[model samples]
Structures are given as C-alpha cells and as structure tokens.
Target: MFKHFYGDNITEDMAMKFRNAAVALNVQISPAQVQGYLLLRKEDPQASIDDIATITYCK
Candidate 1:
C-alpha cells in the first residue's frame, strides 16, 4: 500500500529520514497525512521532505 502511494524512491531509508525529521520537530504524523504528502509530491515533484512534512503533519 505504501509502495503504491509513495512510489519506489521513497525507500525505508528515505522514510526513516522523514520520520527522523518529524521527531526532531516534535511533530506527529498520521497515515492520512502520509496520503496528503503523496498527493503533494504528485503535484510538486521538487517539494522537499521537510516541506511535505510541514504541510501534512505540522498542519
């Protein structure tokens, strides 16, 4: 399910980086927010993980 939504570039390592960034910022991420991130990525391929994270999780 994650593979289908996130695509191949978002590997475990990359996901861990995202999780780590969230932890660093004391942000809590949810599955729905992940879906939102995927959509945001589809719209803006150049969007950074931090930006996506902020948009989805930081709310």
Candidate 2:
C-alpha cells in the first residue's frame, strides 16, 4: 500500500516507528489513517515522514 508512493523504502522499521508513535498517542493505524497520510503527504511535500506519521495518528 504505502510502497506505491515510497517505493520499497516503507519497511517494517518504518512501520514500527509509526506504530510506536501512534501507540504513544493512544491511537491506532488503520486504512483511514494511511489514506489520509497519503493525501496529506501530497499536499505537504516538504513534511518529513515523522511529521506525516504524527499527523496521521493525530487525525
């Protein structure tokens, strides 16, 4: 799914990072979050992966 935009770079480590961050915020990652992140990434190209992930869980 995320490989579509990030190529082959979206590995377990990255997912883990996102998951950890989400967990810390008492949030969960779901399809809706991924889709929203993709859209937000498109709208904010300058945002880092961490920033995007943070926003995803926040939403």
Predicted candidate 1 versus true structure: per-residue lDDT over 19-47, tens digit per residue? 56656766566777767766757644335
Q: Which runs in model 1 stand beyond 4 Å of their true positions?
A: 1-4, 43-48, 56-59
Name the 10 consecutive residues with the lowest summed lDDT in model 1. Answer: 43-52
Estimate the lDDT of model 2. Answer: 0.58
Clashes of each: 0, 0
Off by over 4 Å in 2: 1-7, 27-30, 42-49, 52-59
Question: Which pairs of residues clash in candidate 1, taking residues 3 or more apart in a chain or in different chains?
Answer: none
Q: CA lDDT of each candidate?
A: 0.58, 0.58
Encode model 2's per-residue lDDT on 1-59: one tens digit a residue. Answer: 44455555567666566555556766557777766776767543334356754664535
Superposing every Cα of model 2 onto the true structure, what RMSD results?
4.1
